[model samples]
Target: MSKAPFLLGAAFVAIVTGLSSIFIVDERDQVLVLQFGQVKQEVTEPGLGFKLPFIQDVVSYEDRILGLQTQPLEVTLSDNRRLIVDAFARWRIDNLIDFREAVGAGGVDAAQARLGSVVSAAIREILGSVPLNAVTSDDRTALMNRIRDIAGREAASLGVEVIDLRLTRTDLPDQNLAATFARMRAERQREAADEIARGNEAASRVRAAADRSVVEVTSDAKRQAEVIRGEADAKRNAIYADAFGKDPEFFAFTRSLTAYERALKSGNSSIVMSPDSEFFDYLRDAQGPQQQ
Candidate 1:
């Protein structure tokens, strides 16, 4: 029984020593072994790793792409427009040795702080050179490309690569937006008024043209009717003149008889007859009582 207790104690010690020396590194991680506050080895491959029993320390970092989202920043354009710009960037550690040397295992937070400075500087420099319209228009793509190039170059010294840079949103301050909307509304109203004035002018021109056409048509019709009536009157006068020229005495005699018949048809009339009267002569010739 005394030997059994001694053997169990020895077995427990062996198991503890083995467990303390063995370390596991996952596929998604990079392990750094430190001995006495100095870097001993950097194990990046996924496998079972061994270390000094209780003398070494292990620190692991992610081996995947890192995401950095910055707080919204207020930037001003050359044209004096103020806007809040929200942005994000994708980055990855390209040289683990350089990253470890520079940042000292702070990992994402250290990388983010360094990257944020570069991003902010590049954004300010580019945005200061452009007007507000260019920043908000389709030209924004070109601006973002320029920003990416500059940011990547800046981050290269930190052993990092900027995979992508994006501006998530660009917006005006609330106070400025209300003022801009008011100005836009006023400009639209002025344009509408100008269009209405032009329409009224065109309508007036059409109405005046119609009135002139009516006058011209009526005058032409009246002139044509007058010409036709004048022609008919002239033809009747010509016929009468030609007939009178052929027989003047017969025409005179018929006219005198017509006058006598018209005078006698008045039933209340009384006539004093004279021998030399033309009326008496016409009556005597008709009756065949005297030859004159």
Candidate 2:
């Protein structure tokens, strides 16, 4: 019975040994087999892998690209402008052996931390040499590419390759926001004042032109009325002259009658004159003062 217990324990240990000696590598992972903390085999492809049981072990790292987001960093531009900047990067391990050697036991996490420092230094170096407008303008793309190139060189030592780096956010600091907004508002107000002044000038010109037109029209109408009135007076005087030329006695008789009618229009009218006055000649006889 003691021998039976010993045999069962041996079988269990053998099964455990077989299980430990075998490993399965997924397509998404790159594994390193280590013996006494030294890398023995680098399994880059997906397959069944084998290692010495109880003496060798495997460490797997992600083979695909990884992403990292940096904390907001303040940068002073060449124009003496301070900006808050946040950036992100895409990276992947290019040399598993070098990556493992550099990061040691900390692996991907340690590599990411070191990569972040390199990226930050590059960001400061490139952005510090340019003005604020360069960072905010279309030239921003070219600037970022420069940063990536600088960061990529430094990252090569850590066996990390920077696929891409981009500035995720660029903004004014909280302390400068109000000042910038105030300056923009003042500029807009100045432009609005200029537009209003221009509009007023245009309106004054229109009003002046309209007033001039009104004066010209009034003067023309008054001149035309006077000309018509002068023409009518000339026609009436000409008609009177022709009638007087036709019969001087008849014209005198008619004029005297018109004067008498006006002088005695009202029943209570009184006139102080001599009895043989020319005014009474028309009443005395049908013949006028010419006969007298």
Candidate 3:
């Protein structure tokens, strides 16, 4: 029984040592073997890996791309404008050995901190040299490329590859937003007033043109009417002259009768004259007057 217990204890120890000697490297992971806190080997490939039992330990880092979001930063533009900018980055560990050497025991967390600093510096440097309009324009793509290049160069020492860095949001500070909006509104109002004034001017021109057309038409009608009236008067005078030539006594009689009707029309009218006046000659004799 004593021998049996010793054999069982030895078997248990061997099984534990066997299990501890092997480690697994996943496809998504890069591993470093550390012995007594010193890097002994790097296991970059997936599958079974061997390490000294109990004395060695494996540390792993992500092999795939990673994302990071930076806090909003206030940047001063070349034109002395201030804006709040928020950015994000896509990056990956390009060299595991250099990354381990740079970060030491701090690992991914330390690397991220250093990389974020580089990005911030790059943002400030590039943005400070440009005006606010350029930052907000479509030309920002070139500016962003410049920032990425600067940051990428600096981050190379930290063993991180910056694939891309982009500004996710850019806005005026809270204190400036209301003022900017008010100014824009004022500008729009001014433009509207100008348009309204131009419209009024055009309307006045249209009204003046219509008035001139009406005056021209009325004057033409009046002129034509005057011409027609003159023609009618001429015709009436011709008719009277022809009648007088045909019968002088009859024509004089008809004219005297028309004059008597006007002088005696039904109204409160009176005329004082001598009874034997020439104006009453027709009334005294229906034959008008003795022929001259």
Candidate 4:
């Protein structure tokens, strides 16, 4: 019983020592073996790793890409437009030894802080010199590439590789939004007014053209009617002249009857005249001016 207890205790101590002297290196992590605050070794590949128990320490950093989100920053453009820019970046530890050297015992938090500073500075530098439209235009792709390049170069010193820089939201400030909307509405109203004016002008021209055409058509119709009436009057006068020449006495008698009928049309319509007036000659005798 005594030997059994001693053997079990020895086995437990050995297992504990074995576990303390060894560490696992996962694929997602970069391992650094440090001896008394000094980097002694780095393990980039995944597998078993070892360090002196109670003397050396191990620190791990993410080898794969990590993310950092920056706070919203207000940037002023060349045209004096204000924009609130929110951005994020992808970064990873490219050199474990250098990362330890640069950040000391600060680890990922320190590295992220460094990245944030550099990225923010880069954003301010690039967007500050350009116009608002440039940042929001098709050239946005190129601008983001420039930002990543500049930030990546800056982050390299801290053993971090900046994979990409992403701008999440770029917009005008709250105070400027109302002004921009007002300008847009004003522009639209102006355009509408111009279109209405043009339409009115076109409509007036059409109306004027129609009025002129109506006047021309009415004048032409009146001229044709006058010509036709004159022709008909001439024909009637020629017929009358022909009948008068063929029979002078009969024609005069009939014409005198027609005049008498018109002059004495009704009994209520009276005219005072002499009994031997020439007007009564036709009524008194149709054969001659004197009674037979």
Candidate 5:
């Protein structure tokens, strides 16, 4: 019965020793085993691990990407405009020994803190060099790339690799928005006014051209009418001159007959006669021939 108790006690001690020595590391984790406060072994693969009981310590760090998001920062640009910027970064522990030496077992959190400061400083430096419009629109991507390059180098000394850095949001301060809108509105209004002035100038030119056309048309019509009247007058004068040149005595007799007919047709009557008058010669000749 005493031997049984001793065997049970030995089995308990062995169990304790086995439990203390055995450990497990997952695929996504790395563990550093320290002996007497010095690093003894590093288990980087997924498998069962062994260590000295009560004399070794294991520190585990994530072997996957970690994320760090920063609070929104109000930054001033070279143009003296304030902007709120929010950014984030992804990183991972590259050197476990160096990471542990520099910080502690809390590798990801410590790296995040250090990298956050570097990113903030880099952001300030880059953003402060650019104008507000450049930061908001023009070279934002390039600026971020340069910042990431600088931040990556800074983070390397902390035993971390900065995978990516991104801008989440960029905004103008509330106080500046109204002023920006007003300026935009004024610019648009000026453009509209310029267009209107151009339109009016074009319309005036068109109206002047139309007036000139009307004047030209009227002048052409008047010149043509004068030419036609002059042609008609020349034709009438030629006809009259030909008739008068052919028989001057007959032309005078016809003219005298037309004048006597117009005078007899009037309501008032007057007579003046002589036997030897040329007007009576035609009547006298007719009567004498009948008498003979």
Candidate 6:
């Protein structure tokens, strides 16, 4: 009966041992097998793994690219401009042996803390040297490359390789935002004023040109009318001279009748003058007795 219980206990022990001796390393993880806190094996590939039961433990970190973001850091540019910059870095553990020794069981947290210091230092050094315009412009690519270089050099000690470094956000500090807006608004208003002034100047010039065109057109019309009137007067004078040269007495009679018609054409018209008046010369001549 005692042998039966012992045999059952033996099977139980074997089952437990089998379970504890086996572990798995995931495809996304890099595992370091630590025996009593000392690294014994580094498992980078994914599959089933084994270790001494009850004596060894496993620590894992991501073998793929990992992102570590830094809190907002303030930097002063060469032009004395203050900027708040937040950046992130893409990194992975390259030297697993060194990582195990330095980070121990803290894993990604310890690595991130150490890496953040390096990145912050790099940002201050490279970003602080350039002007704000450079950081805000296309030249920022070169600046990021330089920051990555500096950060990568410092990260090597922690068995980390920074593949990429980027500034996620860069902006003026909170206190400066209102001032920046005010300056921009003022600049826009100034430009608007200048545009209004230019438009007014152009309109004035157009109005002056139109007024001058009106004067020129009016003067030309008046001159043309005077020339037509003068031509009509000259034609009438020539006709009268021709008529008088052809027949003197008939021309004089026609002139006398025209003057009498003007003086007495209306019903209310009256001439309070003697019959011998020149105005009646034509009537008097018509009424004279017959002569040879």
- Separately for all candidates shown, the number of backbone clashes (residues 3 or more apart, or on different chains) is 0, 0, 0, 0, 0, 0
- Model 6: weakest 10-residue lDDT segment is 283-292
Ranking by lDDT: 2, 3, 4, 6, 5, 1
- The whole-model C-alpha lDDT of candidate 6 against the native structure comes to 0.89
> What lDDT does the true structure give each of the candidates?
0.84, 0.92, 0.91, 0.89, 0.84, 0.89
How much does candidate 3 score in TM-score?
0.82
Q: Candidate 3: where is the Cα deviation over 4 Å?
A: 1-7, 231-254, 261-272
- Residues 39-124 of candidate 2: C-alpha lDDT, one tens digit per residue: 99999999999999999999999999999888889999999999999799999999999999999999989998999899999999
User: Quick one: best lDDT, which candidate?
Assistant: 2
lDDT of 5 by residue, 53-141 (tens): 99998888999998989878888889888889978888888988878887765567777777888898888888888897787675467
**Model 1: residues with Cα > 4 Å off, grouped in runs:** 1-11, 201-292
Best by TM-score: 3
For model 4, the stretches where C-alpha displacement exceeds 4 angstroms are: 1-8, 178-186, 224-292
Task: Pull out the clashing pairs in model 5.
Answer: none
Which one wins by lDDT: 1 or 5?
A: 5
Candidate 5: misplaced stretches above 4 Å? 210-292
The TM-score measured for candidate 2 stands at 0.77
Q: Could you give candidate 1's per-residue lDDT for residues 75-152 as a string of tens digits?
A: 888999888886788888887767777787686688789889898788877887888888888657788878888999
RMSD of each: 7.2, 4.3, 3.2, 4.2, 7.1, 4.2
Write the number of the candidate with greater TM-score, choosing between 3 and 5: 3
TM-scores for every predicted model: 0.66, 0.77, 0.82, 0.75, 0.70, 0.78
Worst 10 residues of 5 by lDDT: 283-292
lDDT of 2 at 48: 98
What lDDT would candidate 5 get against the real structure?
0.84
Q: What are the per-residue Cα lDDT tens digits for candidate 4 across 1-292?
A: 3699999999999898889999999998889998999988889999999988889999888888899998889988788889999788988888888888899889999998888989988998889888988988855878888889999999888988999888887999999999999998999999999999999999999999999999999999999999999999999999999989898877878888798779878668878989998878767775668534
